[model samples]
Target: MATKLGKQTYQPDNPPFIISTGTVAGPFEGQGPLKDYFDHVYTDTLAGERSFENAEKEMMANACFTCLQKVNVTPQEVDFYLAGDLLNQIISAGFCALELNIPFLGIYGACSTSAEGLALAAMLVDGGFAKLVLASTSSHNSSAERQYRYPTEYGVHRKPTAQWTVTGAGAALVAGYGAGPRITTFTVGKVVDQGIKDPMNLGAAMAPAAAATMVQHFADTGRGPEYYDLIVTGDLGKFGRELAVITCASKGGFDLSKNYNDCGLMIYDTEKQDVHAGASGCASSALVVYGYLYRKMLAGELKKILLVATGALHSVTSFQQGASIPAIAHAVSIEME
Candidate 1:
């Protein structure tokens, strides 16, 4: 039986292992600092497709196929496919599902979709409902921009706190029998709003939510920041990163200065890339988790890791209505046994 810890945490007695992962990045991401970590990098952001949406679909499908190939599993063998993205109605995930022809469950957690998918898949497998499940997500700089903000063709000047949406796709295979990093537990977050309304400043919009979830995770697990080898945030850019540290310190007495890091800050070189603050979107945390962290865990470098994927749940309609951005973050605890 799964144990519910505190308010929002779940600890499964038999945890599901992340057997394999596949990641693909766009041209911009290919040029980023973590370029070497990606498995595939598209020279053309459109990826030979007619539209950016099509390109995103192709990237996600390719990532799913690549994940399956790593473990030599076919789509037919996967019991369920769990995925989501930033597009409206999750079109990217839907198109990818159409190609894979697997049992699909489309989810939406804004930028936190990756972790939400993984958490749900882990629960499905741990609950003995499925033997294998695939969790995947994607986000294109072009696609997300048009959906949430002005199209890139507008060439709108970005604010200093703006975070670049990641142009990439990342997928992972989760199963019960595997010798890999196991997802031991998870904590789901609620929508949190701190009255931040600027769409460009996603980091600030999401920092409070990240801090809330991190504090809840510690409280639920009865562990301090030192319990994990590293505590990673999904994409709380630069300003958000600093704010999260401050919020955690004041809110929970947790000074995460020693072991905390942000995927947004780690993924790109802000100084050269001119990405204002850093990176965001679904792939922000996905690429880092699937490409960099997974390999490091296999090499025995990281024994225990906490991945907290944050999201800004804002839409053009909501932003236009003068509503504050509501954010959420989901945390997955990974451990190598």
Candidate 2:
């Protein structure tokens, strides 16, 4: 019954099972290295929708419905839908909720929304508050660019340190009774700001938070680096992942060079894709975890996974107002056994 573990950590008495998962990607992602992991890939980013926001909503809906189909559950059967996206007011999640016609809880964790929703949904199911819950998140590169930086018509060149926002959506189904990987322990991270104000340089801003959360998870769960078969971070890209490893080592006096991978780096091939740093967005981690790694867990190739999802919690208004980017990361432990 005791769910709390250390500061900001939660060790659920009964870990909810990850019953099913779904992933959908755009044309660019379809051509990427992990293209086969996606359940559906759109030939166009708009998916025939007039607006990018509508496309995003459709993408999210496709993912959620795909997940439901996999488990033979209807939207009405899902007790709660906890979802979010990078758009202003989380319009994608909101519209998707309306279409799905299910009880919804809209969240905002930037790129970390996927793991954040998973952790919250698992808590609800494990606590007996709900028999089944849906945790979903999405992002579209075009939508994000138009909202955060410039309109697609402007065609601004991306910086070398900048990361391409992934155009994809992922959905995870958590239930009290299911046959799949279980959510074990989670470490909720605190907001970390190193006074880095450049929006393009998110790697430098978010690395500290990823490191802080990873170190806290180790201390709280008493699980060293070797305990997890893989340590995965969400949307940190290549540079951020490198700095996170170094930062964790310096803070916790342990090296994280082994069995560590970033979803951003794993989503795309840096050389092939024009993604400068790597991929970053809610779906970056979503597609990798739900699309790629979940299958690995089910195949017995992986047993234990420490998934740390990082988000740059900065807004367009905040950036224009000269506010520094504050990053946050949430860590969740997943076990196949």
Using all chains and alpha carbons, the TM-scores for the candidates as numbered come to 0.99, 0.98
User: In candidate 2, which residue ranges exceed 4 Å CA deviation?
Assistant: none
Q: Which candidate gets the maximum lDDT versus the true structure?
A: 1
For candidate 2, the C-alpha RMSD (Å) to the true structure equals 0.9
The lDDT of each candidate is 0.94, 0.92
lDDT of 2 by residue, 1-337 (tens): 4368778899878889999999999999999889988999999999899999999999999999999999899999999999999999999999999999989999999998988998899789878889999999999999998999888889677788899999999999999897999999888889999899989978778889999999999988777999999999998888898899999988998889989999999989889888999989999999999999999999999999988999999999999999999999999999999
Q: Candidate 1 — which pairs collide?
A: none
The regions of model 1 sitting more than 4 angstroms off are none
